[model samples]
Target: MPSSKKKSSAKKSATKPLLISAGAVLAAITLGIVSWQATAPAGTGSSGAPAVAGPRTDPAAELKALARRESGDKLAVGRADAPVVLIEYSDFKCGYCGKFARDTEPELVKKYVADGTLRIEWRNFPIFGTESEAAARAAWAAGQQDRFDAFHAAAYAAGSKEKGFAEHRLVELAREAGVPDLERFTADMAGGPAAAALKKDQEEGYRIGVTSTPSFLLNGRPIAGAQPLDTFTAAIARAKAEAAQR
Candidate 1:
């Protein structure tokens, strides 16, 4: 009878383990539901997260701060005096910008900037709010760590998903991009003139009448939206040709 009771106790223990597993699964699902509810973009439900506001029109201190905090001389992937400068004002949350980063820019870098015919300068226009600003700050901080290009590619590689651009996500993206000093990077994100630089980019974009993502300023010529490869090729060629003539 004692042995029978022992066997019964073992059976009960096995059932208890199963119950515990089921509870864990339920708990995970519940947590996921709560997190989803909290993070769902601005208007999914009455209880949805609040809307993310873009930059304000305050005296443009963010831009100035960014410039001051910027450690490098200039963010050119090629020669500064390259015949053509392709200034891209982009938002990380922009699909077209992501496509350009993934599809167009690689070939362009190889053909133009890498070969020294064009200089590519990226400006962050964080029109998407906290997440966007955080992403830009991560990139700037990564740049300080000498991994700007890597971080940029990582940020794009993280995909064009909108709300995933939060600070923690940016840090993860930076990690994927091979940023060595994660702690230092995080600290830099809060420090320096990051806010100012970001603000300035937005103000400058506003001043220049930029109303779209992935806008191109080819030697100061405005090209709205993402155009095909040939359009950029032609523009670069034209700029270089004109420069040569001068």
Candidate 2:
């Protein structure tokens, strides 16, 4: 009896760390969802109302480590070794995502990407439904030909989402984005690789509790919604300073 009791105690002790780790993950995800709900834009399908405030605190280290920083990442812009990285998880069908793409992204690219101070990595996080998933795959296919940015722009252009992301529409967008081989683009879009890539991105977003479109992580600091340009600039400045220190 004494030996059995000791073994039971040892087993409980062994499970404690695993339990703690799981709890931490849950807590982080809860915080991320709350933060996003707090700051998400009105009509963005997150809160369905105007944003009240921004993130309450910086994200956990586990969330920050989500940056891929891969040199050959086709869906990313700026130098691979840039001091700061901004990870954007967005749905192509999202209006606010389009707003960010059209209004704010260009400025960011011109200022930060051109200077090599920041890298922007895109993750396909379709939440609307099948069309959103198809659009995401098409974007990934466009990236195969080094045309992700162009495809993104064409897809997010005003009135583009209204046209819907049907197979024909996606192909048309690819043509507009200057994807060289329409045949190859179509094939790749329907291929396993695109699905795998989309799955990886979706899993990452869900793990970090991204319940809305256009959620961002700047050096692991969560910033929800399509906020003003100054919000991003300020965050970038702070992230840059921190990176310089590290």
Candidate 3:
């Protein structure tokens, strides 16, 4: 009886991370259709529309807790101790995600990330099937070579998503990003680390109730959709002020 109990505990311990990773990936690919409809109302839709900005419902503690603040994270930009962190849950296949990447993200990178006031950590929450997942993995692989931002720009370049993310296409994007080692890029994309990294981001997004692509958490208060620059700017300011108080 003790042996059986030990075996069950060992199994549970071994399976926990796999359960979170694979389960969340499967949910993003499958359950997302239903989950999005159910959970998206708190945030914006896929069209970059804003949710009703009523009184803030998310608690201050939770909002502040979302910042990873990891200096070594290649997928993130800005100082680790940046006063405000914007956690973005996005998919490569999402139109609004592309829109934000193109139009809004650059300005934020310039005004905030450059100044070391706001940190942006990307979450891979692919919801558009195999190709989207592939793109996410490719992006994560690019991060391994310290070219994630460059890869991000190329992947989200005007009309890039329309081209789709075949293995060759992803390789092409990696080249465009100047990833230095094409052979390594290809191998890394299919390797275990990329899958594990993608799974971790996806599970965190799901756990926090993100139901749509381009969903953002500015200090943990959910901002659904690809909101405008002003919306993000205001949220960043509030988060910074709140952080200062602490």
- The residue-by-residue lDDT of candidate 3 on 62-104, one tens digit each, is 4456577899999999999888888888899888889899999
State the local distance difference test value for candidate 3: 0.81
lDDT string for model 2 (1-246, tens) is 999999988988977421123344445676765566465565452314443364435445546667778999999999989988999999999998999999999999999999999999999999999999999999999999999999999999999999999999999999999999999999999999999999999977885677777888888777777877998999999989988888
Could you tell me every candidate's TM-score relative to the true structure?
0.68, 0.78, 0.76
Q: Candidate 3's error at 19, in angstroms?
A: 32
The TM-score ranking, best first, is 2, 3, 1
Number of the top-ranking candidate, with TM-score as the measure: 2
Q: How high is the CA lDDT of each candidate model?
A: 0.68, 0.86, 0.81
Between candidates 1 and 3, the one scoring higher on lDDT is 3
Worst 10 residues of 1 by lDDT: 60-69
Clash pairs of candidate 2? Answer: none
Off by over 4 Å in 2: 1-59
Q: Output the number of the lDDT-best candidate.
A: 2
Task: Put down candidate 1 lDDT per residue, 1-246, tens digits, no spaces.
Answer: 999999988988877521123234334433433454455465543223353364223222222212222225334477766777777788888777887788888899999877889877788887777777888877888877788888878778634455487777888888888989999999988886777767767765655445567776676555656667887898889978988998
